[model samples]
Target: MKRRTKIVVLGSALLLTAGAASAATASEAPSPRGAAVSEAPRPHEAAAPETDRPREAAALTGTAKLHRSAGDDITFSFDAHLAAKDKADPMKATGTFAFSHYQNGDGARAEVAVDCLLTGGKVAVVSGIVTESDLPGVEGKRVGVTVHDLGRHDRLGYSWAATGTPAEMDGLPKCVSSAPFEKVAKGTGDFTVVPWQPEF
Candidate 1:
């Protein structure tokens, strides 16, 4: 009986040891559905190329005269530059904008200090505060302007054109304006614009 008991004890010890070893092995093994691991680039394959993106620096300098009718016309000039590193007024600009409108034989002109400028492709939107004006109620008011350089077919638009509503004249924000949809007069002037993608 004593020898039988001894054999049973020995067999149980070996089985427990084997079970513990098996559990450890299972724990250390990687699962087939585990998280993916990134592989190193192949020797013959070139590294992936980065996407092309536009820089934040841009410049726009142009002048144009647009005719509205036989005796009405609008002329403007812009010398604006943008190098945005943050969101602030003037958009880091050192530029000026001048506009003139002639109706029959009467004329009015306004000069502005640039506040903001945004450009993309051949289009640019500019906003400024009127520093001097011959037009009534325009001085000290914010105004918006837009321009499009289409080679010989440049266009321009203004927020204060056509006597806008009180909200439009008083509540216009920086860097906001309408599209440049008005056509430039043939042989009147030309516009040159350089645009860049703005980081929003």
Candidate 2:
């Protein structure tokens, strides 16, 4: 009976030791399947890099010259030199103006178009409408002219509206040449140019 008692006590101690070890192992192990998970970042919540920010439009000021063709169906070809109002870069422009009379005899309208080459090897095509008042007078009067881009695939787009005067050279009753002429008028204006976002 003493021997049986000794065996029983030994068995109880062994069982308790096993139970404590099992409890410790379970506490150290990872959690079961259904615990909460951390969320991934959303697109809107992320911050944009500094280089990805959009560029602001630039203000520009410059000069222009128009050599006009005489007679009823007149043609005015022009060249413009422009500098950014706040920057050191310059732009060059060359284009033509063709006039058409209104059927109602009110006045005349001119279709104007020009190719503007900017400093950084970019090209923009500008076009707009003009009136007789926009032309340089024989007395060298300043006139207002406005033009916008023709949707060319340029990063920088341009639109300008400014006043300028003409400087006519002494000659005969003639029309403006298709090429640059000696007897040309001078013009100047101010406007803004904007840049488009870059494609990835």
Candidate 3:
């Protein structure tokens, strides 16, 4: 064949091959825009099993002792003066704590509280309050913690109410970045007294 004729034949062959490949791609289903939808596994591995949930926590010894003065016209030895930047806090008063298996993810919490009777613009009588609950994987044991309602005066009142465990403080302080005395400038810098920790 002539040189020019050979060149024409080669180009035609290339075009035919390209056309066939395009036709094949067009016949396939188009993938949606997001992650490829993969079916859940047979056992479904995302949500934790209902039975896997931890049982209530067991009772333990806990305390909340403050080492500073707050402006509440009521200062107790353990009356917490915290200033939480995140989550709803319920420390309405002040004192020590030791609680377990908190319920009401954002409503109720586990804790122990204590304070002295208000006297001379300060609390003078030390008393205690405790919240009780059970721990997961543990039975016949009741855990408690002392709590103060710091959220009483909050305009945005408590929103972050979760349980905590003293063993590891599972998800307590880390829920928000703060100390026990984030509210009281007088004692905030020098004092520290918290109420509870999330369960394990």
- Candidate number with greatest TM-score: 1
Best by lDDT: 1
lDDT of 3 at 166: 26
lDDT tens readout by residue for model 3, 107-163: 122333432111111111122333332222212222222223233211100111222
lDDT values, one for every candidate: 0.63, 0.26, 0.25
Candidate 1 per-residue lDDT over residues 91-190, each given as its tens digit: 7765777776655556567777888887778888888787776556667888778888888888876675544421236878887877686788887556
lDDT of 2 by residue, 78-187 (tens): 23333333233322333333322221222233333332323211222233223233223322211222323212211211121111112232331111211111222323
2 or 3: which has the higher lDDT?
2
* Total clashing pairs for each candidate: 0, 6, 53
Candidate 3 least-lDDT 10 residues: 7-16
Model 3: per-residue Cα lDDT at residue 35: 52
* Order by lDDT, highest first: 1, 2, 3
Better of 1 and 3 by lDDT: 1
Distance from true position, residue 160, model 2, in Å? Answer: 16
